[model samples]
Structure formats: structure tokens, C-alpha cells
Target: MFDSLAEKLQATLSDVRSRGTLTEDDVNAAMREIRLALLEADVNFKVVKRFTNAVKERALGSDVIGQLNPGQQVVKIVNDELAELMGGESAELRFSSSPPTVILMAGLQGSGKTTATAKLARLLREQNRSSVAVAACDVYRPAAVEQLITVGARAGADVYERGTDADPVEIAKWARERAEREGKDVLIVDTAGRLHVDENLMKELAEIKRVTNPTNVLLVVDAMTGQDAVNVAEQFAEVVQFDGVVMSKLDGDARGGAALSVKSVTGKPILFASTGEKLDQFERFHPDRMAQRILGMGDVMTLIEKAESQFDETQAKELERKIRKSEFGLDDFLDQLRQVRRLGPLQSLLGMMPGLGGHQLRNLRVDEREFDRIQAIILSMTAEERRNPDIIKGSRRIRIARGSGTNVQAVKALIRQFGQMQRLMKSMQSGKMPDIGALMRQAR
Candidate 1:
């Protein structure tokens, strides 16, 4: 997820921010470092040149050169330019006024187009509450249709796939009609892709577009392909008029090239990003938030949004009540842990926190196995022990350890941590701040 680029940029910015005032030479030096970072990240050379020039012009302007905390001003300018370069604002999928808004999905073979189709369907269904139905028109690929069916079902979208024999155009047209007749809110047509951009691919896509008259035409590009993905998007732009891009494999160690360059190169914003393999991992791309994340400024808005989506009001209120009454036990803790796990990887969540981005995030190895061990240890405990951990003694500790396949020390550490958390909660409930220094001493 732009780890290399983020590290280099954050390091360069860290140095810039340390300076009290920035001279022309200082700005040039920082810009040179940034140029190198972007180039190394495989960003388009033209885009890199344009972006650097813009940042330099802004940094050298009168507003920043002699200003208080000039270095901070320079960093702000870079963040702004980076966000602007990545399409300033997030793009939204257009829906038709009529029923069954048609969305045509296009891409080259192995671009994760099929998977992205299902992911987008799931997102629209969950976020927009749309009755989504995905049409499997990728007949050329062997298992493309079946794959769409499997993933689409998991996404809770109706699959309107006419197996591999039917013409993709006909399937798309038929699927749209069916969706309209069935009163579906959306119909996503997943078109066939080729090994390379060929006449047949464009021709078939054009025919499908003509038939479906989609409200949106989304090009799914593999973000991990770096410059090649941008090139592919450029080619697609030349042949078909896509409304936006769906960047797949964004969770991979993508050098941050395609995601940064696609909008600039193809004149299309990336509407969605497929961050992981799971259908639910897809999310709308927000250029500002991404720029902030890359710059080591946490994206709290996105973090909060994730929490809101996973934890409903009733559950949150119940948890708060339990905490206030000192009734939050191992079972409540387990449930909370599971809810957080659903938000995504812990490392990713941490990366969204301010001061924990880039190198800091890379340095922290958040062992997901620890979570598994915690779950196992809690499950191994009796209901009574979970309700009141204080009841466990010497013999009970050893038995619980063996049952959980863990060591006594591990169980002890977990209980200690939980106790500290409870103490902190109790302090808050009593309208007093806990003694953090004392707690640190106790933990040690």
C-alpha cells in the first residue's frame, strides 16, 4: 500500500518539517528528494514533472518562503498538491433516474475485473442499499462466469449470468432488461477482457456499451502493475469512454504509481479501490484521505466511518453501559475484539492513526496470531471465569493455559492488560482521569 513511497516521502517531509525557515535552496532540495521518490515509485514522468513544478511554485510563493513555520507550510503544500494530483475529490458512481442503473465493467484479462465487479456490487448493495444484480458477460475466460456467480452470491447480489455460450453483448442487454423488469436498483455488466487490448476487445465492449447504455462505465485496473496499469488505462480511455476506474489489488505492495497516475493520465478519477481479496474490502477512493495517510497524517474520518459501519448504535450503547457498570467481562471483550477485527487488519487500522504512518507502521509487526491466541484463551475459560476473572487461582490458571494451548504467563499478561483497561474505564466512569504513569509502572 505505497509503503516504499510513503516511507521516502514521510522521511523527506520529516526533515523539511524540522527546519525553522525554508530558503529557495532548501525548497529545491526537498523538491529534488520528492522528485526522486515519485520517480522511484514509478509515477509517470510527465506527471512527476508537473506535480513537482506545482509544489515548487507554491512553496516558493511569498505566502510560505518567509512565513512562520515555513517547513510546515511546505509540507501542507505538498499534501495539497498530492491530493490534487490524485483527483482532489472522490468520484461517485452515477445512477440513472430510471430503475436499474446499468454499470458496465471493463478491463484487460487478469485485471481482477470479475472480482471487482462483485466487490462493487457488494459495496453498492451495502452502502447505497441498492438491489444489485451482476451480469456475467465474460464468456471468453474459462471460469469467469462461474467466478462471478460465486462471488456475486457472497456479495448478496443476484447473478444474471447466461453461461459461456451466449454472446456477451446479448447477455448484457438481456441482463439489463431483466433487471429493469425485476425492479432491481442496479445492474452491473461484467464484460470479457483480453490478454491485451485488441480490436475484438474494444469492439465487443463497444457493442455491449451500445446495448446497455450504462449509467457508468468503470475500468478495473490492477494497481500492482505500476506504470503498465496506467498505460492500460490510457489505452482504454482511447477506445472506450469509462466514467471512472476501480483500482484492484490496492492492498498489495503497489508502488503508488497507477493509483496516482491513472486519473492524470487517463482523465478519469478512480471511483473505487479493491483493497483486499474479500468482497467487503472494497471502498470508495478518497484522494484527500489517501494523501493524508501517505503523509503520515492519520485518516480519522475513514477510521470513524469503518467503526460506524461495523458497530450499530444499539451495540455501542450496550457496550458503554457495560463499561460504566464494571460489567464488561471477557465475553464482552471478545465481542468487541471480533468487531474490531471486522474493520480490517490491525496494522492497517494502526496506519490510520496520526504519527503511526509509513516507517512507523512498517516497523510495527502486529501479530494477528495474538488475536487468535486471545480468542482461544477466552474460549477455554469457563463462563464463570470469563464473568469474574478474579476467581481464577494457581490451579485454575494452569488448567486454563493447557486448555487454551498457551503458557500461564500469556494468560497472566492478558488478564493484567484487561484489568488495566477496566481500571481505566472505571476512572472514566467516575469522571476522573486515570494515572497513566502509575499504570505504566504497574504494567512493567
Candidate 2:
């Protein structure tokens, strides 16, 4: 998300960490570069100033200067202050004690409020509260209500949509009532957005708020909007007094300035970040993990969480048993591939690994097409041949190659790689944890 900024910050911190001692002059010089990086990343000027000042004050304090590994201590200070600037802790969605907790979604045109609404419903469903109702109040756009309906269907939630003829306030009120009657636990009202901030939009939103009496007002901001996002958030907060901010499009090459500045600018915590268009791509915000990501240290906790979510414990244990017995086959290999794919794109997964970003993986493109080819090759093998690859003689290899529509050499390469991977898995199963850095070095 903040790839460029992360790279720059990592380099700057590495340089500082390499030094034996840190002086005020050294800290000032580093802060100057960091300030420029933040400005270039489109962080709000005021937020950047405050952030740098906080970092500077802490860096020059007695705890850091002339201490052992002063450079590292200073970097730690920066990370801590950056996390504090964004909000020291994650904010949880506050459910009303009364039935049908109303959540008002507000944002500008194309800010992904509707999609986030569905994503939020899906998140709530994961918590075992499945009765979610989406109220579409965006009557300005012709298909806005329909879009919300479709999203609601995808999220397995009920939709409270009124036609274009109804006033938004009335629609919201009716939707709330319907949710209460239906025994829904939560009501999400997707409000309309304007091309630009104006009196009419604010008045309409205010009217909706008056009618719905939402328990939480969330401002959805596009991370790609950079510094301008802060102003938009502030404007919305002034009118609606939003409880929190949702930063969308963290999967893009967003410099992350909006994410860094929004909380400080709006005086609200960032509750969630939407990484992609997929329903499950949204993640709850964590200040410490975000701090690690911003410093290019890799978010190990988030990575582990993602892995745990995607990896099946039973399947993993079965695979371990197969590897221990030296019975790992092409079928197992295919299963592993699917598990890795489920985690996320291969590049993103690798990028989260320590020391595995930027040029380190410049040539590895693990797209669906590559997976398709591998799967086709595996599918062409007979069950017996897959179980015991040694049984595949020259004639069998030719038949398999023809079936897969690949050349003989490609088939041979796949077989060779599969054998090596099986051996590696066996070694790992035997308690030999391979050094990932060495593996990358070998790949290079």
C-alpha cells in the first residue's frame, strides 16, 4: 500500500541503525528526509509537522541518544510515534444496547462506501451475528439501490431498499423499522454521495442522521486521495460528526498519507482498511502492525493471521503425515498450491515475508494462468502415476505431455521440481526449518 514510502523509510532507518552513535544533527538530517518522504507521499502538512516534532522530541530524549544501538532505538521511537499518530489502539464497532444497531456509511462519489457496507456485514457474520440488513439510501444514482441490493445478496444479508420515488429519510426510517421487525441485529444505511461537498449533500445526510439516529457514523475515505482525503474527512466530520474512518484501497499503490493523517486530522480512530474489492479483503486496523508495515519491517502478526485463516489444520496435519511417509504426490502438491492461493496473491504473501520485497521478487509472477498450467499438468497424470512418479516411463511421459498440451521438457521440469519440493517438505517435516533468506538466495 505504501510501497514507495515504505522503501524510503526502510532505507533511511537502515542507515540510521548502522551508525554507532546518533547526534541531534544526525536525527535532524534523518527527520528532514522523512519529512520530505511524508510530504511526497501526500500526507497533510500539519499532520506531518506534528508527527516529525513528536518523533524528534522522543528521539532526542535521554532514553535514546548515546544508548546502545541508538539508531535502532530512534527507529523504534519513530514507529511508536507513528502508531500513536494514527491512534494508539484499534477501535471496535460499538453496537447499541437497543435492537438493530444503526451504522451510517458516508463518503464521496466512488469512495467505495457501498462495497464496504457489504464487507462490514460479512465481517459481522463471521462473529456469528448473521442477521444483517443493508438499507440503501442512495436514491440520487439510478442503480445505487440496486447495487446495494446485489452487494447485500453477495454478503448473505437482507436489503432494505426503496425505489427512487421515496425520499431518502423516509426510506431509511422504513428500513430501520423493517430491520427491527425482522429481528436483524444490525442495520447498515448506505447514504448518497456528491461529486463535491455542498450544502445540499450535507443537509440530506443530516436529515438521514436525524431520522435514523445511527449509533455509529463512519466516514469512508479513499486511500488513493492522499492529503485531500484529510480535508474531506474533516468536512464530513464537521457536519455528521463521524465516529471513525475507513480507509479504502490499501491494495493499491497508495502512498499511505491518508491512512497516516486521517485520524489526526479528524480526531477519530481508523477502524478498518479495505484492501481489495473482494468481500473478505477488509481487515481491522491495528496500529502496531501498521507501524511495522510503514517501517518495512513486515507485519508478521498480520501475515500469521492471514495464514491461519486460509490454512486448514486438518489438511495441514494430513499433508505432514504424507510428507513424513515420503508419500507426497502431485495431488498433495496441488492441494498445497490451492492453500497458498487462498492466502492471497503470491507476490503479496511473499512481500510480507521478512527481507522479501522489491527487487527480491521482481521476476516472480504467480498469477492464475501459471496455476492453471500446473494444475493441467497434474490433472493429466494417472492416479497410479501421480502416486508413484517413478512408474511413469517414456511412453507414459509422452502420453501425459500430450494430454497436458505441454512439451516433453516442460513435463520433465515439472517432475524434477515436484521431486525437489517433496524432498524439501520432508526435510521441513523432520524439524529442519529452512532459512527463508537462503531459499531466496538460491532462487535468485
Candidate 3:
């Protein structure tokens, strides 16, 4: 999501890295560019000034200026400062020694708190919190309780709602009691939000906090709101004193101002972030990994984690066997596509890939509907036709194209792409990385 800033910072730092030696003036110039980039990306003014100053001091310090790779040292200093600016380490939700660890969700209207609550539950489930429960206390908004229940079901967490008519605080208390009685490991309370920060909203949330005595209060902030999100978080922090923030819609936020400024402005860590709309799209925020990503160094650890969680091991082994035997087909290609989709958006994955950012990422736009078309074309074919794509000649291609609502040319392109993928895998097996330069020349 730090697309613009990442691009600018990478370019500015790449110049420094190219130099064999560094002068103080060179470091100053780079820091100037970084400061501008952060401002352009809407990072908080005070935070930007402090961050740039820290980075400049480290960049021009004797330790870095005397180093064999002074330029690299400067880059490392920036990376370290970025991590520290964002709280340095990952912050996990603190649970109590007692049962039913309460997590109070707080945010403004249109902040996507309801959805973040569900995503948090799903994340907890991944961490072995099997008996997670959620209390839908957002009784002010219409259908808020029902929305929580629906999303809560998808997250595999039991939802307790005393209907919209009941007092939110009382409902939260009752839900906590019920969760404790039922032996739920965690109870997440979805609190109501208003269009603006108001006394009534604060009072309601404070009352809920007083009644439940939540272990963690997470403020859900929409990353797309940019600096406004930081302002809202600052106000919320003063009133409700949240433990951390959950940044939702980060995938859609190209500027990433909220993420970069939240910790600095509110003095709270970003505990979690929602990368997409899917329930599984949320994840624990790791500042170090995020700093790496923002600096165009890539987040290989996060990428590997996503792979370990979403990629099928048995299917991967089978696919390897198929590639070695030249048995990989359109069926396997489709399966691979689906598995990749499970890892979230393709563009987000590309950002996590080493040496792929800035202009390269901007040039590549992942169209999910293309996968639909490919699936349709494959499904329109017979079993034999899919097993052996060579048999699909002129008339067969036309028939498949019409059936799949695509042109015959599109069918031909799919086959060609599939063949290229098979060859690419075979090259990989030979311990050689096949270059996709030609394929990537086309933006589509």
C-alpha cells in the first residue's frame, strides 16, 4: 500500500547504494528526498521531521561514513528508523490470566470495525483459539447486530447479540458472562461508532469498557483515510485510550499514510491490518517486515508465511512430479491459479517479492476476472481436450471460445501461456531461474 512512497524512497536510496563512497552532502540530499516522499504520502509532519532527522544522523555518523559500504549503511539506518517509527516490533493482543480474554473493538463510522472484528476472530482461530466468541454490541446502527452475526459465523466464532433494543453495555456484560460460562477462550466485543468523535460515543464506549474491563481495546482505522485516520486515532486515544489499532482496507490504500503515522501520532502500535475484504485477509502487523516492504527490500518472511498457510503441500509435490514428467496441464494451471488467489491479491504478493516494486509493480495490474475467463475456457472443454490441449484445433477452439464467452484468440493465448508456465517450471527444476522478461514487457 506504500506504493508512491516506496517508489520514491527506492529510487532515492538506489542512487546512494550505487555510490562507492558517501559524503555528508550526499546523505543530506537523500534525506531531503525521503522527507519529501513522506510528506507527499501524507505522513504526519512532526513524525516525518523526527524520522528524517534520525535517519540523517545515522547516515552521516562516523560509524556509517567509515564503513566499507557506507551507502548500504545509510539504507539500513533508514530501514531501522522506519521500523522504530512504526513501533519496532509486532504487538500481539494481550490476554488476561483469567478466562474469556476480552477484546473491545472501537472506531469511527465507516471504519470497517464490524468486518475487522470478524477478521480478528479468524486470525485468533489460526493461533489455536478455537473457542472464540464475539459480542455484537453495535446496537446503534441498523442491522449492525445481524452483520456481526453473519461475519462472525464466517469467522467460525459464536456471536452473542441481545438485539438492537438492549443496552450495549448490558449486552456486553451478559455476553462476557455467557462466554465465561461456556468456556470461550476469547470474547471480542464489537462496539458502536459515530460519524464523528462525539461525547456520547465516548461515553458509550467508556461504559462498555467499565462494564467488561476488556483486556485489549483495538481502534479500527481505515487506512485509506490517510492523515484523517491519524487525527481520529489521536482523538480516540485521548478519549477511550485504545491499546492498539487495526488498519482496515490497507490493500486499497496506495499512500499508506495512516499505517506510517498511527504509531507516531497515537503512541499505540498497529496490532493488526486488513489487507482485503476477505475474512482471511487480515494479519498481525510486523513493523520490521513492513519497513522492509516500504524500502523496496521485500517481506520474504510474510510471503513465506502466506505460502505455508495457503499453499497445499501434497498438491505442490504432485505438481512437481507432473512438471518433471511433462504432465502439467490446464487443469493443473487452473488449480495453481486458485491456490495463488487464496494467498490474497496477486498485486500484494508481488509487493512482498524481492526486487519487485515501484514501476514494475505499477505496470502489472492483476485482473481477477481474467482467472474467471480462464476457468470458463477450461471448463468448456471435454476431459480429453483438457488432458491434451493439442487436440483443440480450429473448430474445437471456436466451440470452446463460444461456450466460454470468449474469443478464439483468447483461448489460444491461454494455451500459449500455460505452455510457457510448464517450460518455466521445467527450467526451475534444472536449477535455473527462467526469465519472464518477454512476458512482462506487456503491461496486461
After superposition of all CA atoms, the RMSD between model 3 and the true structure is 12.2
Candidate 1 residues lying further than 4 Å off, grouped into runs, are: 64-68, 299-444
Model 2 misplaced regions, further than 4 Å: 64-68, 298-444
- The TM-score measured for candidate 2 stands at 0.67
Models 1 onward score TM values of: 0.68, 0.67, 0.68
**lDDT measured at residue 222 in model 3 versus the true structure, 0 to 100:** 93
- Candidate 2 residue-wise lDDT, 139-212, digit = tens: 98999988989988899888888788899999998998898888899999998888877899899988889888
Top-down lDDT ranking: 1, 3, 2
lDDT of each: 0.82, 0.79, 0.81
Indicate whether candidate 1 or candidate 2 has the larger TM-score: 1
- TM-score order, best first, reads 1, 3, 2
lDDT of 3 by residue, 51-147 (tens): 9999987677657321124665677788889999999989988988898899999999989999998988988888865689999998888789989
- Residue-wise lDDT of candidate 1 within 174-272, one digit each (tens)? 998999999999999988888899999999999999999999999999999999999999998999999999999989944899999989998899999
